[model samples]
Target: MCSRDLKTPWIDLNTLMRGQRRVLLRHGERPYQLSITRRGRLILTAADQDTDTAAAAAPPGKARS
Candidate 1:
């Protein structure tokens, strides 16, 4: 829901997340992690490089938080 005179590109979660709770995005050598919270909120953070950098949508792990 945007109201502006200028134009902007937007991507839906269904298309972006692709039915998963988490997805890894890469820009240059940096890795970004996008996650869906338990409250149905969105969070984007720098991902750990030591882990997998496959840039795939992964099934959410057990997070009671």
Candidate 2:
């Protein structure tokens, strides 16, 4: 299993990735992508790959009042 040091402010991407192709992050209903580049750089992006599905699955109560 992967472990993280909560007391530290940094995240070890290598450990986080764990040989995975990509990592998906979900905030409420929105999804984000984290990936690595060929040049050994980290990339973060808003994963809009499934906008329709996300919108359909989103809870209505999460909307602004």
Candidate 3:
């Protein structure tokens, strides 16, 4: 016989961020950056800080398809 009743700890999203810009930083030979805007939009910036990687990676010409 086996039991499946288990309790997990709760994690708060705000607590994780702690009121700061949350950016995903890739570290390696070819590093990159990604983040969620205050308006709740996904953003990607290159090292040059002029190109939007997310926009470029987006499906041809669709918001999210």
Candidate 1 residues 1-65, lDDT tens each?
Answer: 55863677767888987777888888899888888978899888887775463433555554222
- Segments in model 1 whose C-alpha atoms lie over 4 Å from true places: 1-6, 53-65
RMSD of 2: 11.4
The reply for model 3, stretches above 4 Å from the true place, is 1-20, 48-65
> Which pairs of residues collide in candidate 1?
none
Q: Report lDDT (CA) for all predictions.
A: 0.72, 0.59, 0.48
User: For residue 40, what is the lDDT in candidate 3?
Assistant: 62
Whichever of 1 and 3 has more TM-score, that candidate is 1
**Cα-lDDT of candidate 2:** 0.59
Query: What is the TM-score of candidate 1?
Result: 0.69
Candidate 1, residue 11: the lDDT equals 72
Among these predictions, the greatest lDDT belongs to 1
Q: Distance (Å) between predicted and true CA of 10, model 2? A: 3.1
User: How many collisions between residues are there in candidate 2?
Assistant: 0
Q: RMSD (Cα, Å) of candidate 3?
A: 9.8
